[model samples]
Target: MAGTIDPDAGISAAGEPITEAEALQRLRQSEDQSQQYYAAWWLGRNRSRHPEALPLLLATLRQRRPRDPGAGVEENAIARNAARALGKLGDAGAIPELLAALDDEDDGLREAAARSLGELQATEAVAVLLRRLASGPAGAGAPRLDSPRLQEPCEAMLEALGAIGIAEPGVITLIEPFTAHDRPLIRSAACRALLQLSGEARWAEPLMQLLDHPQLQVRRAALMDLGAVGWRPALEPICHTLAENSLKLIALRGLVEQGAHHDATIQAGAVLSAMDSLL
Candidate 1:
C-alpha cells in the first residue's frame, strides 16, 4: 500500500525532459494539473531565479480539486508541489501564500507548506505553526484513515520550527512532549527540533537511537534529522548508522560542514578519516 502512493503522484511527465522556457509556460498558463506539478518541480529543481516563478507558484496555491474522501487523500498535488517549489526557490515572499496553505483542508498541502515555511525560515510563521502542532497530527493513530502514504505531517511542522530557530521557552515547552511520540519519524523530528532550537546535545540521544529503527524510512529520517541539527557528538554514531553509504555520506558531509562553523571540537581531519571506512 505504501508503494502504491508515488511521491510524484503518478505523473511520468514529472520526469519528462522540457526546456526551461517550456517549463515556465506550463507553470504560468497550463490548465493541466499534471503540467502544473511538473512545471513547479522543474522550475524549483533547476533553482530557476526567474522573476515570474515566485508569483506563478504562489498563484497555484489557490488551485483545488474535489476531495477524494474514499481514497482519503484530497490534496491538490499541483498545489503541494507548488509549495515544495516555493521552498526550493528560497524566497521569503512566498511565506504569506504558504501560511495560507497551512489552513488548507488537505493534509499533504499543509505538510508541503510547513516544510517550505521552514526552508524559507519564515520566523513570522512560528506562532501559526505552534497552533497547528497544538492541533495534533492530522491522521495519527486512527486505523480507519488507512493512509499508507503517511497522512500526518506533524513531523514537518516540528521540523519547520527547528529551521526557523525560535528558542523561546514556550516553543521548547510545546515541542518537548513530541520527543516521546510513538512514531520514530516524529520522535526524530522532535528531537532534532529540540536540539536545533536549544543547542542541547541531550536532544541528540533519541535521534541516534533511531539509527536502529526497524523501518528504513524511519532510519533515513533519523539520519536527516541528525544532520540538520548539526550535532558533532553524533559523529561516531552517525558513522555506525546501518543506512546506505550514500545516505551516511550525505549526513556525514552535512555534519562536517556544520561542525566547521559551530563545533570547535570537530576535527575536520578526523571526520574525513572516518569517511574513509565508508569509501
Candidate 2:
C-alpha cells in the first residue's frame, strides 16, 4: 500500500488552512476591509512560517490614505493591528519600520510599536523608547483605572525597557529617577525594571516598602515582579501582606513562585491568624 498524506497538512502553523503565498496575496489585494485586516493579522500570527510577511506588513502599515471625517476610530484599526502583528512577530528585520511607528500619530499604534521593539529586544530602540519615557505619562490626569496594565504610553515604555532586560551602562541611571516619579504606576514600573536589570541586594528593602503603596495596582505589580526576580529575602514582607484580603492572593502566588513552599500550609494559617488578630 502507498503511504497517504494527511489532507490538512497544507494548513499553516497559525491554524489557517491556507498557503502563505495565498495569505500574503490576500492581504495585499483583498478589497473588503475586514478580510484585509484578518489577512494582515494572520500573516503576523503565522509569521514564523512566513518570514516573507515582514515586507507586506510594513507596506500595509505605511499606507496612510486620508480617511473621511466621519470614519471614526475604525479607520486606524488596520494600521494599528499591523503594527501589533509586527511586534508579535519578533523579527529584527522589522526594526526600522517599528522604529518609524514609534512616532506614529496614533497613540495606540505608537504603543504597539514600542511594545514590539521590546519583544524584539531591539537594543538600538532603547534610546527612542527612553525618549518616549522622558516625554512623560500621557494619562497623568486621566481617570483612574483598576489595573497597572491600563497604564499610559509612558508607563508602557518603561515596562518595555524592563521586558528587554538590557543592562546598558546608562540604563540604571535613566530608570532610577523614575522610581520617584510623581505617578505611582511609573514608580512601580521603574522599580520592576530596576530589579529585572540588576537584582542588586540594595533593591530588596525599597521594594519591600513599596508593598504598602496606596494604589493596589502598584502593590500587585511590585509583588509580581519581586516573585519573578526570585528575591527570597522578601519572604517576610510577602507573608505579612497575605493577611490583607486584597493582597493575599498575589502574596501567596509570589511566595509559591519563589519556591518558599516549605510548610506553606502552616505559614498560611499563621497569616490568617495574623489577619484575625487585626479584627
Candidate 3:
C-alpha cells in the first residue's frame, strides 16, 4: 500500500537518457501519473541529459488535475513532484516559478517550493519567503487547522532562509523575534537559522542559552545547532551536559562532529560510560 500510494516518491530518477523528445512528450502528454512523474523526475535528476525538461517541469506546477472527484478535491501530485524535481535539478531559472509556488493553495506544493528555494540558495526569494513566514498560508500566526500543514510550511520557510545564507541586518531583525516564539519548534528553528546566517561564535550565544530551555526538544535542538555551527565556546557546556543527561551519545557526537578535541580522553571516557549505561 505504501509503494502504491507514491511509487516514485522516494525513487531517484534514472540518469540514463530516454531521448529528449520522448521524455518531454511523456511529461507533457502522458495520462499515466507514474509516467508523468518519472518523466519529470528523470529530467530533473539528469538535467544534463535534457535541459529542456526544466521549463516543462515548471509548467507542470501551474497545471492542476483532480485527485478525487468524488470528494470534490483536486491534487497536483504531478506539480508537487515537479517542484521537488526542480530542486534536484538545481537550476536558478526555477527560482521564479518556485517563489510563485510558495503562494500556492496546496500545502504540499508550498512546502515543495520552499524546499526547492532553499536548494537553490535563492537570495532573491528571501523577502518573499519572509513574507510567507509572516502571513502566507500556514504561516506563523495562522490558526492551526491541520497540525502538519500549519507547522511544516513554517519549518521549511525558516530552514530555507538559513540555506540562503543571507545575514542582512534587516533580515536578522525580522527573524530575531521568532527566537522567543511560544512554540518550541519555531524557537528551535530560529536559533539554527541565526547560526547558519552568522557563523560567528557571538551569534551562537543565543543557542547556548537555549540549551537550558525547559523543553527537552528545544534543548536537543540547541545542542544540535551548537554543534552544527561548531561553536567552541560551548564545548565545556556540552561536556557538562553529558554528566547529567541520558543523551550522552548526542553530546559526544556533537563534540566529535565539531572537532572540539580539547578533552579527548575525557570525552572518550564519557562515551564509554554512556555506552556502558546503555548496555
Candidate 4:
C-alpha cells in the first residue's frame, strides 16, 4: 500500500484502488511524510466522508516538524495540507481549527486556513476576517502599498468574506477600499468580494479589465474573481481572454451556473455554444 500516487488515475499505489481506509491509514500511520501529504490530498480530492477523516485531518492540522532547510519552507507541510483538505471536504467542523489557524505563526498555513474558511462559507469568521484585513499590510487608509506589502492571506480574507455572501454595509465599507489597492491581485480580490456580496456589474467590470493585465498571474486572478462573481456578462471577455482554455472553461462554467438561476437548459446551451466557438 505504500507506493506511488497516480493522481490522474485516482489510485494510491500499484494501480490498485484506494479505499477510504487505506488513505486514512496512510495519513494516520505512514512513516513517509510525503505519503501523508499525498493521502491528505487524496482524501480532499475524493471528499472522503468516513467517520475518521475529519479527526485524522484535524490531527494532521497540528502535526509539526522542522523542514529540511533546503526545502525553502519553514512550516509543517502536513498541517498546511490538512488545512486545505478540510476546506475541500466542506465540513463545518473544521471551523474551530481553521479559525485558530488564522493566527498561526506560519504565513502560508494562515493563508491556507483562510482559503479553507472561504470554502466552508464560515459566516462566523466575517468579523474576525475583517479585523485581520484591517490590520493587514494593505489595511484601509494605509499608504500606497508595494507588492511585498500585500499578503496572500489578506486576499484570502477578502475572498472568504465574499464567499460568505453577507451584504452588511459595514462589511461593504471595509472591503470596497481594497478595490483600488496598489497590488493588482489585491484589487482583483476586492472587486471579486464586492461582486459576490452585491452581484453588481460595476464590480465585475474592473475584474474584466484585469483580464488584459500585463502579468499572467494578475490576469489569472482576474479570471478567477470574475468566475466567483458569476456575472453572465463576463462570458465574452472570459472567452476571449489570453489565458489557458482550462481556466477560461472554469470561468465560463461559473457563468452558466449563475445564469441557470433563471433558466438552466437555455443557459447551459448558450454556455456550451460559447465554449464550442471560443474554446
Candidate 5:
C-alpha cells in the first residue's frame, strides 16, 4: 500500500475520509507532533467551512507544557496559522486569545493576533487598545524607547479597533484623553477611531471640538471623520475652515466622498476652485 498523500487532501486516516467532527476530535486528542501539525493545518485551511475547528485550534495553542513551552514549535506554528484562519473566519470566539497575544514578545505573533481581532471586528478589544494609547512613554505599561517596535503593534491594535466598528462607551471616553496625547501620531489615530465609531449623534460634538486640535493632521482627520459621519450641519464651519486653510485638501476629499452637498458643497467647491486657480 505504498502511496503518496496529497498535502491538500482532506483529513483522513489510512486514506479514509474523515468528517469535520472526526477531524476535530483528532485535533483535540492528538499528542503526536506530526498529527498535531497536520490537524493545525487542516483547521487553519478549513476554518470558515468548519467554524467549530477554531476553538480546538485555539485550545491547542493556549495549553502550555514544560516540554512544549507555549506549545513549542508545533503550537507556535499552529497558533500563527490559526490566527490567520480566525481572521478569515471572523469569529468572535477568538477575541480573548487574539487580545492576549497583542502583547506577545514575538512581533509576528502579535501582528497576527491584532489583524485577526480586526477581522473579527471584536469591539471588546477597544478598551485594552485605548489603555495602551493613553499610557505614553512615561505612563505605566507604555512601550519603551528601547523596544520601539512595540509601537507598531500598539498602532496596529488601534487600527484594528477602528476597523472593528465597535461603538464601546469607552471609545468616546478615550477620545478626549487621546486628543491631548503628547504624540501627534497617536492623537491622529485616536481621532480616526473616534470617527469610525461615531455612527451615533454623540460623536458629533467631540468631532467638532477636534477641528480645533493644534496638530494639522489631527484637525484634518477630525474633519474627514465628521464628513464621513454625515453630519451635514457640522460641515458648515468645517467648510468655512477648509476654505481658509491650505492643508485641508484631504478633508475636502472626505466631504466629497460622503456626498456632503447643499450649502457646504457650494462653499467647498468655491474654495477648491480658488485653490486650483492659485496653483
Candidate 6:
C-alpha cells in the first residue's frame, strides 16, 4: 500500500500512462493558488519514481518566490516542494541547477538547494560547497556567530562530502588546499576528507602534526582521525607527545583505547598489562 499511486490526488490518475509533456504542463499550469499547492505536494512526494518531473521541478524552483507578507503573492508551496522533490530524486542532472540555487538570495531556498545537493550526493557540488564553506561567514569568521544562514549550509555540505566518500581524484585535489587554510575548521574538514579519500596510513603523519596545533580542538580531531587510520606506528609519536606534555591521562587513554603502544620499553612491561586489562 505504501507504493500504491493515489489517483484521487492527481498522481498517476487512472493508472494511465503519463507523458513528460503532460507532467511538465501539470507543473506549469498549477501556478495559481490551489493547484500550485497540490502540485508541490505531489512533486515532493513522488520525486524518486518520476524522473521526468525533474526538469519541471527545477524550473519551478527558479521562479517560485518565498512567501513574505509584504510580497502579497501567496507563498509558493508548490515551488518549494518541487525543489525538495528534485533533491529527493537524487539525479545527478539536478546538480547544476542546485549549484545555481546555492547563490539564491533567499536563505530558505539556498538551504533547500543545499539539502537537495546533499541528497543527490552531487560530487560536482562538492567544490562549490567547499568554496562557500571556505569563504562564507563560517570559514571567513564573521561577527554574527548566531546566524544559521552560514552555519547550516556549510555543515550540511561537510556532512554530504563525508558521506559521498572522497575517492575521486577531483575530490582529493579540491580538499587538499583546505588543509593549509588559516581556519582550523577548514583544515579539519580537509583532514576528515582525506581520511575518507584515502584510508592509507600515509595520512597519519600530516594528521599527527596537527596534534601540536594551537587549537586544542584541532589536536583532538587529529588524534581521533589518527586512530581511525589504525596505523600502529602512527600512535607512537602521538603517545610520546601526550606524555611529554603532561597529558599522561589522554596519552594513556589513547594507547588503551587503540590497543597501540609505540614505545618498545613501555610496550614490554606493565603498560601491556594495563592495556590488556582495559581491553
Q: Estimate each model's TM-score.
A: 0.88, 0.62, 0.63, 0.84, 0.46, 0.47
Per-residue alpha-carbon lDDT of model 6 for 72-176, expressed as tens digits?
554544554566677767677777887887776554566567667766767677777666666544353333364533433443454356546647776666556
lDDT of 6 at 231: 35
Taking all chains together, the TM-score of candidate 5 against the true structure is 0.46
Which whole-number lDDT from 0 to 100 does residue 86 have in model 5? 67
By summed lDDT, the worst window of 10 consecutive residues in model 3 runs over 1-10
Tens-digit per-residue lDDT, 158-189, candidate 4: 88898888889988998887887777888888
Best first by lDDT, ranked: 1, 4, 3, 2, 5, 6
After superposition, which runs of candidate 3 have C-alpha atoms over 4 Å from their true positions? 1-8, 11-26, 45-49, 65-74, 135-143, 182-184, 202-279
Tens digits of lDDT, candidate 1, 1-279: 011123674564437798888888997875576677789888877878988888888888777665687765444878888888888898888988899888787877888888888988999899988877674443342222556444347778888999999899989998888777667777788888898888877887778888888898887887777777667777888888788887777777768876665577878777788777888
How many angstroms is residue 215 displaced in model 5 relative to the true structure, after the best TM-score fit? 19
Q: What overall lDDT goes with each candidate model? A: 0.77, 0.63, 0.66, 0.75, 0.56, 0.55
Which runs in model 2 stand beyond 4 Å of their true positions? 1-26, 43-47, 64-70, 135-152, 201-279
Q: After superposition, how far is residue 140 of candidate 1 from its true place, in Å?
A: 7.6
Model 4 residue runs over 4 Å out of place are: 1-17, 65-75, 140-152, 261-266
Q: Which stretches of candidate 5 lie over 4 Å from their true place?
A: 1-47, 63-78, 102-108, 137-145, 173-188, 199-279
Which segments of model 6 are wrong by more than 4 Å?
A: 1-26, 31-34, 65-69, 72-78, 136-148, 167-279
Error of 1 at 85 (Å): 0.4
Pick by lDDT: 2 or 4, better one: 4
lDDT of 3 by residue, 23-122 (tens): 7888888567667776777676565436677878888887755344466433577788898788878788889889888877776678778877877889
Determine which window of 10 residues in candidate 4 has minimal summed lDDT.
1-10
Residue pairs in collision within model 3: none
RMSD of each: 3.6, 11.0, 7.6, 5.6, 12.4, 13.1
